[model samples]
Target chain A: MTSLSTDAIPHAQSYRGLVARRLAILVGLAAVLVLSVAVDVSLGPARYALGDVLRTIVAPGAADLQMRVVIWDIRMPMALLAVTVGASLSLAGAQMQTILANPLASPFTLGLSAAASFGAALAMVLGVAIFPAAVGLMVPINAFAMAMAASLLIFGLSTLRGVTVETIVLLGIALVFSFNAALALLQYFASDQALSAVVFWTMGSLTKATWGKVAITAAILALCTPLFARRAWALTAIRLGEARAAAMGVPVRRLRLEALVLVSVLAAVPVSFVGTIGFIGIVGPHVARLLLGEDQRFFLPGAMLSGAVILSATSVLSKALLPGAVLPIGIITALVGVPFFAALILTKGRKAW
Target chain B: MVSLALEQVGARYGRREILSDATCAPVAGGGLTALVGANAAGKSTLFRRIAGQLRGPGIVRLEGAAPHDLRYMPQDTGMSAALTVYESVILALKQGGGGWRLSAAELAAVDDVLHRFGLADLAQRQLPELSGGQRQSVSIAQTLVSQPKVVLMDEPTSALDLFRQYEILEALRRYAEETGAVVILALHDLNQVMRACATTLALAEGRIIAAGPTLEVLTPEMISRLYGIDSRVERCSRGCPMMIVDGPSGQARAG
Candidate 1:
């Protein structure tokens, strides 16, 4: 199939044009990202300058040991960690829209985030996290399994022989309530420290960002990114109704199966690590739409970057915006994202939307 | 050979049988064959079966080539609000491949069709921005680009204005004549039936009440029985027929 060589591209020029546009957005975002990292690293501890932040990163020994450790070991990983989680949540949001055919859907709204959080909660709160003498993939294995199960149940309920957007939303709402109820039950049984851990986990923070988790998240994201971009078409096609998609030779069920699995897998990883970060999934794509226009190709890339940009900025702003202390990353994301999307709603209203 | 034929096709969802012993055969030459019936008369059920998106009790044979050569555009013509008109058609073209990518020439051909249907200006607009009529138009346009041997459409004009309705039906007619591709449309409007259709299939309660030449199959009795309303079909000038629904005033012509 790869041999088909993408019959869509007329020549390298058109292909290059799309690639150039995508790369331009990526590059611009990357530069801003680097700047955000510097700003974030310089905020606390030794308060390195922008120049020192760079020197501390690359020139290492040029800076004192303490500044280097703070910059390299702490802030830099947090920034990268924030971007990865942000990308995953937004992409999951986009996929949720496609699968359910509802504009208002997000993994959090649909309960995937809460469900994964519950999985992680079960491990920590209940001490049911099985780390074995034998081979085991640990929390991620359980989280992904539970997340997939949660999503499949939602998919099954929303879908009869035929599905409507309203049905999916209602099912998602039901799942969210029930899943949160289950979390409450788990919380009720937890020890005080475990409960505090679960509660703080749901608020989402970059504080837990570690080198190991960043590597795993990046590797998984890099592998899945192409498929995520390509999914825009399938998503649009599926909205036409899975039956019609099948008639159009889309292998509708196969596509849905793979997408559901992929989105669930994607959702589980980040939410397991970052907990239920809100609005990134909902607002990232909307921001992408406003900036790059609504073409899914543009929308997907736009969403990915808008997500990274917002989270990167939030990572910096969370530390600096407050007088003396850091805020949870999710709090800043929602505060910024809510008002931006609110303005979008007010200006457009439901009809314009 | 029939372009699309269903034999003894019976369909049901849960406990309710929507269609039973329904058989449909379109002329091998290919043009619009309008399926007319009142709401819930098994028109949609038959359409789904013909599209092969839904399986029923019959073997659907495709003539002049592969059985998989037909496509169906459902009533909703499901569209992602996020995609562009250009992206929508490209995906339809890519039906055979896991990815739907249209080459420049292919895209140009699709753009031409979109242009003909007055969708050219909105090619880059998001699907969410389109009106119901425009969305339906884009859906119909996407179906044609695959160059399928047969295209099945449900409620093709149920959402459009009079002018857009005529525009869409006329476009379908032109495409059919140009490519000899059969078009099956389940229609709510019978005037469109006489105007654009060469054949008519009237179905009710899972049975094909009548199916044949458009003029003969769509008698006043046939329509009244299908719709459960008092109506009449008559021969009109210009070698075209028309429907007159009986009302309190007198005999009224239904355009």
Candidate 2:
């Protein structure tokens, strides 16, 4: 009896300590993300010193006109885009993994990226705009439209009475194949210039990022994060399995549908703006899971920060590796993400998946 | 007293009825009740019907408690999450309500259950790292952490070892007595039901055959009808009730 009483205080204290530790890890990831973004802004074809970059970012009017324009206009947009897009995609993937109960479920693996690619290809190759009014922004608009269509398809099918999580994931894979085949068909009949445009879009780059794109992505992230935060406990409970979660009064079907819609929007916006950046969705969540476990209060922010740090750091590597020439950001993400993710998986004793 | 009464509750899958007319007396709280049946006898289906996971034909009335005041623990305890034992129990306790932060009382409740289930030592261990029996114990803690007015468990101890099973049942009985909760367990072992549960509800082919005191409801004839087995209920040297199965029933073999 005495032992039970004595143990209570320490157990409560230890759980609090665990929460503190997870918070510290989240802070650490955010710090790394900020540093990497700074480095990403500093390095380019026309490189500036780190101090000048920091100073210019802090006080834009103090820097010279050329430095200000170059940092703010060119490099800063790409860096900020990396953070927002990375955060958005990673958050999408984390929730997808949660709702689907599949470790491999992500924006890239489950056909959102493929659908975006096909949508962009249609706009580029055939000069066909799915939404006729957006002439100036046909590619992104069409891409978003198609990605939303595919996600809604999954979401619609999942709401049926007997469709399981595995069925949803399988349906996602089927969508991946269907979209990829259509993309291939579009490529076959494309003009040379249009073909190159489609190919470049599929490779995924941040070079053409604009401030407007960054704001939109960040706004979407802001909107979605709070919605997810409100259901943090429910999302965490879901990882235990569907029946168990439902038994806990979680309204499992409705929650899964809600998460799917939000995730679709989260994934669609970024892929539309920045093309198909693949590995961030899959790797970011895994990294956060490895560090912080699956508590959504911590896992949600942790995934966003880890993704931002990874993509920001990848942006730095893309600029630094080929000095005057920036490599395709997609290529570098897979190259850097696979080995780093493999190492984490191989080394970690805890089962992340 | 908290009580759960099912009146003509019926549940079915597509084109096939699983449970029909499962009526039970108003079982008041503060003790263990066993729901026993053979495979495909609709034990889990009945629990689901009562838990509101499935839409059935009849009424499940609860007295002195709302629907949310009941928790059902399904048999399958397969967990692959990266959360620790402490966090998983915390997850269950914080299921429907509460904010991001854990209250001191909430933490204390979780700790109390963990200590009761002998899981305080494995508090920091990850879910995927624990053994099968340990995972079952963790699931029990998850079910009871909320201290619900009515608790339904479907084969909760199937994965537990002998000693662990006894210890968990003892903890559960204490919980029901202390909290005045209606605790119903779907168990395959008739002997364990005889030892731990005061009341037993026997089902055969999706129909409630008998419901009353465990000893009266678990007669050799009832066991034969439910499980197609010839069994005898005997007292051990320590005066504890045990079931001694003779063989498959002659009627079952002929049919």
Candidate 3:
């Protein structure tokens, strides 16, 4: 018989260490977010100093209309929108990697984003179901509907043949190509107004983001967070393979489906607003895994925070780089995500992150 | 309450029947059972059938209420090398419901299992960092941590060197005694068959050649049939019965 128990050992040190590390990360994220918002507010045709903005936020009576408009309408919406989209995309990407057990598997890898792009394109270009008299906001409606529809399509296609990992990924890739082709066709036969709309949709933008869209997307992601996190333990088991996973009571098939659904919702909601923001899903998970280790408890939130940090910073940069011009959020994310992805590939790629 | 029986158990891969109507009785309660044979002797296939990994009508009966009562350590270390030893063992315990609130006691037990096989310091080490022997040691610890009533280990020591092999076999025997778990391992090494197993099931071409008490069952004729060579039954230092194959299908070997 063994003489010692982990219970007998004092792990206060480990606990303290983890707590400190987590707090540091959270503080760093908060600092970056705060700094980015500061930069955003102090920018544009009318600049608001840090002291002035802080006082305005706290002592509203002292603030002028321009300051109020800058803080509330322009900067606040952009910052909030960036945080929401970034967190949702990262969580989806991180969970998909674990579920598919492939670091390369992300929102984009499963064709969900491509399908969303198509859906967004169709709504913007065709105005298919846009009734100018009633709900003039057809693109958003079309975007959400088609994004969810694309998600369901990928889900259905993967499960149509019994959910094997290889089959799911292959089907997702195939669907991605199919949806991209459809989007291409939509692009080919568009009016001048429709052409720019379609191009803008593909390029991705958070400039049109409003509090309503952020709230809706946030609600969906919040609902899915638990389901995504619940599989942390099972994802650990699945890495051992299906036979071992089953042997361990993981219910491999059901877990696979649950993960697929969770990721789809996570990806669909974000893509509904941003179209196919490539690499956020792919690189976010890698960053999470690398920074927080492979433990899902930390990986999930780490990825979300990392995504938020990247987007918030990028939003500020994109706005700064193009004065009085709105750069596509997709390009900013691509610029930020691609180099990190290459770094992940160069380093941890061989390490199986 | 813990007995396993396989009847008319046959398996196929496409057109090839790896195990054909294999039948065996429960040998003994405590020690190892060497399902010994040549490379393609269907030992691994039989283990899979028993473990319920491969679907075949094998009239398989396991006494435990849950499959966790039985453990299968696949020959392929089948564990992802990307994970750490702590993570892998934690999974085995999780499956067994060893308890989610891993107190110091339980966590120590997890670590101790590693230490028993010289893996104490390597608990946090990733599987890829492990040598073949270290990986096998971790795999064994994962299998035994559940205190499984029946653990079907396919070549548990196949990856280990000579000394490490003994360490693993000794660990298995101790585990069986401590937990009273029925341990079955498939082995190609005849010496290992002699060292740990209390019984032997000699299989050749998807059929049992001889099986019973390890002493009586492992004979010159049986080893010859299993290994397809001229063999002589011999006695090791501890008076345990073993076989010596002088050459493949040649003569003049006696012990």
* Model 1 residue-pair collision total: 2
TM-score of each: 0.84, 0.97, 0.87
Please list all clashing residue pairs in model 3, or write none if there are none: A5-B104, A5-B105, A6-B104, A6-B105, A6-B108, A7-B104, A7-B105
State which candidate has the highest lDDT: 2
Worst 10 residues of 2 chain B by lDDT: B246-255
Best by TM-score: 2
* Model 3 ranges with Cα > 4 A deviation: A1-45, A55-66, A130-135, A160-163, A340-350, B7-22, B38-42, B54-59, B63-66, B78-82, B97-101, B203-210, B236-240, B250-255
Which lDDT tens digits does candidate 3 get at residues A1-353?
22243234333223335546765876776687677766665665566677887787777677898788777776677778888888888888876777677767887887777877777777767777534443566676666666677668767766665558887888888878998899889989988898997888888788777778778877887898776666666766777667667656677777877777887777777777766677677776676666655655566677888887787777777777878876887898788667767876687653653
Ranking by lDDT: 2, 3, 1
The whole-model C-alpha lDDT of candidate 2 against the native structure comes to 0.90
lDDT digits (tens) for residues A1-353 of candidate 1: 23244344233234335546755876786687667766776776445577778777889888888887888788778888888878777777776776665667787776787777777777767667544431244455555556767888876764465666567678768878887898899999999999987887777888878888788788777877788667656655666666667667666655655666666766777877777677788887666655554446666666777777788888888888876777887788888768878898677532313
Model 3 DockQ, alpha carbons vs. true complex? 0.32
Candidate 1 vs 2: which has more lDDT: 2
lDDT of 2 at B83: 97
Pairs with backbone N, CA or C atoms under 3 Å apart (clashes), candidate 1 = A240-B78, B19-B206
> What is the C-alpha local distance difference test score of each model?
0.72, 0.90, 0.73
Query: By TM-score, is 2 or 3 better?
Result: 2
DockQ for the candidates, in order? 0.35, 0.60, 0.32
Candidate 1 regions with alpha-carbon error over 4 angstroms: A1-27, A61-63, A116-172, A179-198, A240-247, A251-253, A348-353, B24-26, B77-80, B98-102, B228-239, B247-255
Question: For candidate 3 chain A, which ten residues in a row score worst on lDDT?
Answer: A6-15
